[model samples]
Target: MASFHHCIKSGKKGTAANHAAYIARQGKYGQREDLISTGHGNMPAWASDNPALFWKAGDKHERANGAVYREHEIALPAELTHEQRKELVDDLIPAMVGDKPYQYAVHAPRSALEGKTNAHLHVMFSDRMHDGIERSPEQMFSRYNAKHPERGGCRKDSGGKNRLALRDEVIQTRKTCAELQNAALEKAGQTARVDHRTLKEQGIDRTPERHLGPVRIQAMSEDEKASVVEARRDHLHRRAM
Candidate 1:
């Protein structure tokens, strides 16, 4: 099954360029040597901004000057080829970010040692937009607009009546991803399909397994490995009972 992960990070003064460089894999911090390809969008001004200048742009209160960026790491089904995976990601990007500037990288899994290879996409996007005449952060993340309280801003919901939340968007994105993957699988005449719903929601009684990090598992001693295996077996046995 495919997995989903999303995260957001705030960029303080002097860090916007660094974050951009890291995502674009341009500067010394470009550590994703395993990437197959990298792509970017809507960041011409950010790309050219010097560190000092970028820092100055956010010279208001430290809080006001900081920018928030989002990162999403999505697991690509092994059933899809590299090109197909890239195409899927490309289609999803615009839908997610709209007019905001963003960067992404596609990574192929390292040679599998103990399990199936994992391919994934890493996406990073800024929270600001340029409307030809002006550039500003999305209203969803901005301070409350008292004049247009009904429109809300970042902190309040549309109409400023409630708190703005991203739960709905996150859930919808997961479902959309699952639908996209299922469509591809159907086109390929594959039997596998991904589900965005939780096991309980799908009426499945089995307990989900904990994710043991690959590096930690690989470094376990013989006794430690046996203990871990036994724990899993015991859990399954108890569940059966």
Candidate 2:
């Protein structure tokens, strides 16, 4: 099954540019030139504005710096060839970014010894718009309120009272991503698909296995292995009850 991971990175200490540069492989001595790709949607001309500037503008607040950018890592179906994977990602980008300024890069999988060779896409986007107008911290990051002192607010909730919370937005985004991925797989005649729901939500009753890192597992003593097995057995027994 395809794997889905999403996270938000804060630009609190003015490191947004660094993060953008890293993802875009802009600096010298960057690795794997063929592995890097970038795109932007609903954004100003690439010559004028970039991901760093987009996120920096959103984090103008001296205090209470909100999430400057969000990111997603989605595993591409291995059944598809390189060209098909690129097409799938191209289709996904526009759907994911909507009107917000965004940037994405596709990373190639490592050698076979590195484990799963699942190619994935990394996307980063600003939560605010690019209206070319200066805004206060509260105005830029907070919910929309006409009566408030600041101007040009962000998105609002369904009731139109407070700003739409990030948590809700993330959940919706995950569901949308799963649907889009499944569609892409179907188009490619691939049977593998992804799930956005948690194990409980999917009615999975078994205890999920803990991820022991490769190095830790390799170095584990026999006693340690037995301890882990016993712990997992106990967990499964409790869940069964």
Best by TM-score: 2
Name the lDDT value of residue 141 in candidate 2.
57
Q: Which residue pairs in candidate 2 have backbone atoms (N, alpha carbon, C) closer than 3 angstroms, thus clashing?
A: none
RMSD of each: 6.3, 6.5
Question: What lDDT would each prediction earn against the true structure?
Answer: 0.58, 0.62
- Candidate 2 local Cα displacement, residue 60, angstroms: 6.7
My TM-score estimates for the predictions, one after another, are 0.66, 0.67
lDDT per residue (tens digit) for residues 1-241 in model 1: 3333333345654455556566556658567566678777765354433332322343332245455455666677777877777777877787667766667777775632334566777776655444343323233334544566435333311122333346666677778777877787677666666677776886757777567786777787777767866764565345334
Error of 2 at 186 (Å): 0.8
Model 2 per-residue lDDT tens digits across residues 86-190: 888887777777667677888765423224454778777765654554555445555554565255465422223345575677688788888877787888887
TM-score of 2: 0.67
